[model samples]
Target: MLADLRLITVQEYHRMAEAGILDADERVELIDGYILKMAAKGTAHASAVTRTEQLLRQLLGNRALLRFQDPIRLNNYSEPEPDIAVVQIDPLDYADHHPTASEVYLVIEVADSSFQKGCGLKAKAYARSHIADYWVLDVAERKLHVFRSPSQDGYQTETVLREDATISPLQFPNAIAIIRDLLPKLRAE
Candidate 1:
């Protein structure tokens, strides 16, 4: 990191948006104090996100609130919109502010083209926030990368589950998610 590099705080980021410096339709997120452009979502990415959201909704049934591509407050310097965010239901539905780390149950990133960023920078960011649980769905490989046991260094436990495997959020053990259900079915060529 450059010693002299300026880092933008979350407040400044919001101010930039409110001032129209950052357009509402811009595909960018504040990460480690820098605004990073997000990768374009392809069909596989969109489908996987939809499938995961739909299945989680069906299984969770209001036990948790799910937000797709919505910003989650990680810290003063970083706010990223995970592909799917499983959060605690608030009476206000977070109308006043975005869900913070403590309010989040699970953060899922569909890795269509940003797998490295998801498992790397984002992982560290989430771990540092003590978010508890993070998942990266590798659409191309048809695998689910689970990150748990968050620490300042990053997730202590990392597991890669194939489509045939299953998982459940640490917060809601009863709401099990079959890995296959979260991924798009492979179409025959």
Candidate 2:
């Protein structure tokens, strides 16, 4: 007789991560029954995420919420750490529990080596959970890919934002961000 494999809950996954058992630089996510290592983010990816976070914090002020590279629980089946997430309000109330898709206003993934995974797998997960908006910061292509109108399948609306463009969150009608100003500054290090 064959027995079915046990699926780990989102809570269990967090306990392991919080215990500091995983390496500091490890890129990991709990998908299905296993803990998987995601593709290591490159410098461009890191810089782009940083720039976006800074800009978002400045523009939003204390009006909205912000989280950098935090785990978002899509459901019982998946929990992936997105690059940056902008929520409607401060989330300090939920201490250990991961923020569900309903808690998020927008999810941004700054992509370099993990572009495909971020754009594909993560997009689907966010969509299924009814996340209002999703953005993939394409560091290599130097573009911002916006995803909206999510369904069970995925986003029905997708667009690539160029340097001259400004992108705004659908949740906040008055808020807007300049793409050119938000892009990662080229630095020799």
lDDT per residue for candidate 2 within 37-110, as digits (tens), equals 87776777777877888888887888777887778778887888788888756456558576777888889888
- Best candidate according to TM-score: 1
Error of 1 at 106 (Å): 0.2
lDDT, candidates in the order shown = 0.92, 0.80
Q: After superposition, how far is residue 92 of candidate 1 from its true place, in Å?
A: 0.8
Clashing pairs in 2: none
Total clashes for model 2: 0
Write the residue-wise lDDT of candidate 1 on 66-107 in tens digits: 999999998899999889999999999999999999999999
lDDT of residue 8 for candidate 2: 74
Candidate 1 global lDDT:
0.92
